[model samples]
Target: MILPCTSAAQDGWLRLRQALWPDCPEAEHLAEMAGFLREPDKYAQFVAYDEDGQAAGFAEAALRTDYVNGTETSPVAFLEGIYVAPQQRRQGWGRALVDAVTAWARTRGCRELASDALLDNVASHLMHRALGFEETERVVFFRKELS
Candidate 1:
């Protein structure tokens, strides 16, 4: 797998998104992917390719200057999402995806890296732990229906 992204990979990136959100309608999925592609730096996303140049995974990295949950520093690179194909799991492909995005973060002078998954996502929790992220704090959203 390679460590950088290019314009040529946009189509492959969209494919990866579709794989990750299989339930999303094609029109919505394509629109979401296109929004990222419209960015000036494409700093919001990156693609992981397999040996045959197929998109095996995707890592969406973005820099946020304000309110990163675990750190006080500004301009932290937040990993918005990462997904490796089911067949590609457990083969170090996911870690490679993270590594690729981390390297990209360092270039942008990011002082810290941050990512979050749903509280009950066991696999995500394990992956984050394996990657050396600590349990900083747990946040639970509360909701009440308005009648």
Candidate 2:
């Protein structure tokens, strides 16, 4: 089962995020995740539970008013993070989590959903493809510190 991540769910979410992140094959930003969960408008993270009532996976999504990957205007839905346990993969848990998020987005009239993975994350890329995601564009980000 999948459910919204609330204050009560924070600890588990954080733990799962840190655990799966090694294989996440994407960006790592814990402070940002904390802020997003604490701040109302920043994000909506969710967690999935297994038959034993143990947390199995998580997904972090948000309403990005800024430009999304493929849209003209703000993104109706943006997937910041998603992770399923290696043992739990190939089951319907991840897809159920995605469905939950999309359902949440559609309620607000969201048209599209966007997510990104590192260039070399074959598993993630395959998952996206299985979910019917198409590659729109790929741009590498560069950051500089000027103080």
Best by TM-score: 1
- Candidate 1 local lDDT, 1-147, one digit each (tens): 654544534646767777777899988866766666676353567777788877778888888877977787888888888998888888887888888778878888886889998888999999999987777778888999999
On the 0 to 100 scale, the lDDT of residue 56 in model 2 is 88
Q: What are the candidates' C-alpha RMSDs? A: 2.5, 3.7
lDDT of 2 by residue, 1-147 (tens): 887877633546877787766554324445656577686555677889898888889888888888887775555688878888778889977788888888877775678888888999998888888887787888899999999
lDDT, candidate 2, equals 0.78
Q: lDDT of model 1 at residue 128?
A: 90
Candidate 2 residue 100 Cα shift, in angstroms, is: 0.9
Q: After superposition, how far is residue 136 of candidate 2 from its true place, in Å?
A: 0.7
